[model samples]
Target chain A: MSYLQLSLYSETLRLETNVQVILAADPAASPCLLLLHGASDNDTIWARWTSIERYANRYGISVVMPGAHLSAFADMRRGPAYETFLMRELPEFLHRHLGLPTARELNLIAGLSMGGYGALRLGLRHPERFSAIGCFSSGNLLVATGFIPGTSDPYGWISLVMGEDINNPALAGNPDFDLFEILAALHADAPLPRVYMACGRDDFLLNCSRMTAERLAAHPALPFYYEESHGAHDWNFWDRYVKHFLDWYTDTEKTLTETTTD
Target chain B: MANIIFHSLSPALHTQRRLRVILPDSRRNDTNLPWLLLLHGAGADGSRWLRMTRAEYYAEAKGIALVLPDGDNGYYTDMRHGYKYYTYLSEDVEADVLRNFPSLSRDPQRRYVAGFEIGGFGALKYALDFPDHFRAAGSFAGGLDPQSLDPDYCVLTFGSYKQAWQAENDLFNRLRTALTDDTRLPDLYISRREQDYLYTVPDRDFASDNAMTSGHTIKVSRFDFNSADPWSFADRSLAWFLDRICPDRAQLFTPPAAADCPDDCHTDCSDDSLADCPTGKPTKE
Candidate 1:
């Protein structure tokens, strides 16, 4: 495996940011997976906590892990323009510099926690960009704009990421920001990216995942899969399910060799 | 700005290690710039310092080289049952970084360590364990007491929460002994959010103990924030770091360089062929 730590100047975010790229040995013909990290996390979590490198090498695929910080994968109201950087600039950099494929058939996106929300949001908004999208313990489908009963301010933490405009009618219904609205706006005939969703039964965000699955299921033309397992909203769950999701996404013939030992 | 580098055959962990090194853009040739070993929290790696905070921007003018290395959820310890991250941080990583970056200062007085959460614990532990190697240490919302950690995580890290494990790994126990002999110890800076669920009690205890200790060098700063804001912690930590480590320095006050838009423009360039433009601009020919 070859790991490349790239420090690229992000025009969208207007800063020099870090991206961790892991390439399978002899990756000339390998596909690429754009792995997104959760809130307060950078690209390193995937490499540190998960068996991402081994999996990438086993599947002969490359992984691009970008650091979006607390931007929640959104073009932040108060911070960096992460949405534009991740959705556009990063992919372009990979395709140009590393000779990775830019076509939807060879590109995939998956993430856990806040990154799960980002993967789904980016994939749905730019459906033509990726072949499939996997979300683990995602809260993107949850409606979080209103006030919590005990919190001092009703808007709560969601207001930090989505902004106070989340209450505005036009922004509230905007398909680009809301998953349900995005599902509603999807044309029946429009080619949709394959969707895979999973959450731990014990995860706080399990209901959010279920809601997302329900919405995805409503679209008969969309190819969607959902799974629930015994786990929590932790790295253990992500480590297990990320492997499963990758197995489902990749060709079975090229699966990790059974002889390979950890 | 940021340089991604790898160290193969790391003796401490028996694995290849990757780190992101952020150096002052203007001090490439200077060999004695102050160094800060920035550690990442649980489930994070070397990229977090550069990615999650304006650390690189803050360090750029201060002429400090920020070294961020992968800790692999090891809690920055020589885990009783897991990886030896403590050795990696103190011996392997420090040696590797110095070997690679000659411009970074070699003096212990010019080197510092800081981190957030678990990384913060690592920083405190590193400074305590290797008092002669670092001049100052800062912990932002650190998990100071290993016994207070989640049982499952504690078990994985310390083999068992047995008396022996606590004796060997607990920060409080180490501090109690180290505080008696203050010679060579790094000046400690600990900050926590007012509402932090995990570190409030321990932080307060540490602060009180430091206050009671004669010839005290520890400084505890508390901030008010709903839940925890890493950005606020980072901002305060940088200010604290500058005040104690390089006080009243004119260069440290310089603002970050303006966004170089030319490098950013190629991200959204319309031409599909130009999408791979390496120069951050469209190909003219």
Candidate 2:
């Protein structure tokens, strides 16, 4: 993999930010995967916890990881315009700077936690741009009515993503703010991006993925791929399943390398 | 200008390398900007060009891309017992940089490389060996005779001072071979200060000797400044190279000019060996 640590000025964010791009053997021939990180992690986090470089090399795919800070991959009501950066500026920047192919067929997205929600938000909203979505252990997303999904106050911090009105941002009408709305509102004449949802059975945020997967499966137009096993809300689970997600995305016959690594 | 630090695992040198690139801020969409491969000398990392001189500003002013690579004390060579730095710098660096910025010019006429001490020799070797790849190269206060260099550095880098790498790194011999074989040599810019010790005091008159070879077409251009400070060579040479390559742009390589400085600005830099000056610290390059 030809790894590049890139720092460029973002017109949308109005600041300079870092992006990590790893290219497979030939970027001109590989599909571009927009891999996002969780709230506590930056662009360089995934490779540190997973053998993403070797995985990219073996699978013959290019991975682009961008730092979204604690933005939850959303253009916060009070924070930097990260949603604009990721949706509008990011693809254009990658296409111009790295000469990445910009056609919808060559583009895909996936993430873990906040990034997982980001993958669903960015990928589901624009079926014209992305062809596949992978969401892993997305958190605190109960329904479109109340996005802050939790039994108690343990997950209250997720409210910071939506400045005021954390309990109910009146997002049901928008259908673009929360994961369930986006999954529910996805409408296309043709099913383009296949959706993959996964979580650890022992993970605290397992219900989010389950509910979202259920909503996506009931959509009648979307192909749903869901999986769960023994694990917790940690990198080991993500490290193991990210490979499986890649296998399902590439339409490869499932291999038992997961058992070996786990 | 934008400073980009590119970190990569190099298979050629078998090490993790963090190389920097100075990309022009304007005319970025043109995609045909001239490229300059700048190598750092011994006793320095890649930042020597940035910390010691305003090379990036010069590059921006000239609308050229400056590629700065770390040429360790091994003199940018594929050392016998050390790393294959030359291969990494010349081959992998080119690929890595182009991979990152695919818009940079690939034309040989728009490509060049230069350096200060061991870096200068490295540039010379690069240009001579692969003239088809580079249109020009420059050496500032370096690559004189190789024997005039520190014995310890020479022995540690290349087995012996007298014999090892003598034929390979000898610029004079390589130039003769290029001329004899009609290899279509690149334009050369060689220079050294009059009060300099490593180059001017040696038996070779590198500038005049080069003048004799490239008179008709003005291929070998020499512009040795009047400063006595060896520390000032990289700054002056970097400006000269940029001005020579992109003459149309405003010349930002120089300040008010060395002539405008105090008479004793570089007076203490005439020591035969690297040493501390009466007025300042030791020169790193």
Candidate 3:
């Protein structure tokens, strides 16, 4: 278990910010999981989970965590876009500080809550780079509360990202400016990536997750694997659900063998 | 000599996108070296990896040169309205690597592609779609199948199934089948935070199931850290993987050179230890 903390000048942000990372380098492993945290929390939150330790040993896998607290990992007009910072700036710092391989199959992203939302957004928004993704207890953006005064509204902390309100209304900088709309458009236009999600039944935001599930269900063209369990929005449920997802992903490889044989 | 010749994206490229090159140091500039092209996710540019991790330094030290290309919001793909990005990164970017950098290996084994977030998708997509381009690959927090797994995000981002149908058509099935079919796959490494906020149960399960059922050379890790600060996790995990697949590149093993150390600091400094160089040492003066 090694931890690397880095602070650097981001050409994207044009400011100096700090990035925290942790890794379990396993030489025997092939693909490395690069997990991103949700809004408000830091990297340590994931460290608190005992399953992480078990998964590391159980699968001979390694982990990479990047810190993006409060900031929505958005590229904005106000400050250096956090999205860019995490996607590009942060990786630079990690490559130098830690001895990680540079390849396509070696990286993956997963998150919870807001981070889960970001995961789905970022993953489909860019399908070529990531082969797979996992999102747990995500907030559905299509819902009305998706964008409030401070949470995602540009006027709040995210203002830097959305910029001054655009007159077009259609092109407003609001992060939630119809995220659902964008996804619908892309689904119609391009090849959306393979995505998976799990939510607890008792979770307060279960409706949001349910709505999300329903929207995709309408799309016969989309091929997504999903599951809903009896739990809540708390970390405990998220923890158990994430482990299950990992287990399923581990088992998905057998399909390839079957496909080849068939 | 291995050297990094950076090409600032011209105004057109910059406004349209950002691109940078990290070549081997002058000492490794002989035949073509192996090339590692990184694609960043979402709002990030080519320089993202440089900022997040000391990738350029490691690449320089490791003898593996890097090509960082901006993906913008295109997800490393060619979006609507003539966003020729998918071609830019896969075809044009490779062309540039072959022409300008000696670090690019003619052998596919020496070539690799990788990214974080959206870039993760780009890395995997490039490798999966273009299997001959690179021998191995990686994705950090990349997206898998959202249509079924994450409907809320799906509707929010894409609006309706009618609209998302085109982009999502057969994507999951293809990937599911592809992961299960190992004959044409690159070495893959997938990781996530145990308590991650995104890519919940379904996304994680999709990848995991593929790995478990398909016999794909897929690896998984749930680190103790979150995705926001995944530098350390990515560094350790990626380094471990690279060392195994592309071991000949010595620069990967070498650490970044001290920026503050002057030429004579190594000789004039009293501290003999590598960490004791004037620039390396902690000093009030």
TM-score of each: 0.50, 0.48, 0.42
Worst 10 residues of 1 chain A by lDDT: A148-157
lDDT of 2 by residue, A1-262 (tens): 6999776657776554668899877776788899998755677788877888777877888999998766667775544577788878988888887877787888889999878888888887778888888988883253523344342322222443464444444434355566666666666685558888889998878777777777787777887788888887789888887888889988877564554244
Summarize candidate 1's per-residue lDDT along B127-157 as a digit string, tens digits: 8778888889998778776766778667657
Give every collision pair in model 1. Answer: A11-B264, A147-A154
Q: Which residues of candidate 2, in runs, are more than 4 Å off?
A: A139-160, A166-174, A254-262, B1-285
When only the first chain is scored, the TM-scores of the models are 0.87, 0.88, 0.75
Candidate 3 local lDDT, residue A62: 61
**What C-alpha lDDT values do all the predictions have?**
0.71, 0.70, 0.57
TM-score attained by model 2:
0.48
TM-score of chain A taken by itself, candidate 2:
0.88
**Candidate 2 chain A lDDT trough over 10 residues, lowest sum:** A148-157
Give a tens-digit lDDT track for model 3, residues B30-146. 576677777665545555567667676666556676778755555455433213466677776767666765446788877888777657767877887877778788776665433
Docking quality tier of model 3: incorrect
**Candidate 2: pairs in clash:** A131-A193
TM-score, chain B, each candidate:
0.78, 0.79, 0.68
User: Can you list each candidate's DockQ?
Assistant: 0.02, 0.02, 0.01
Q: What lDDT tens digits, residue by residue, belong to model 2 across residues B1-285?
A: 878877776667544466888889976786887888988766565776886788877887888888888655557777543456788878889889788877678899999988887788888888878888887888776655567666755554565776654777777766655554446777777655444563334344333444445541222223344345544677877776777778798965442333433566665432211222343332233
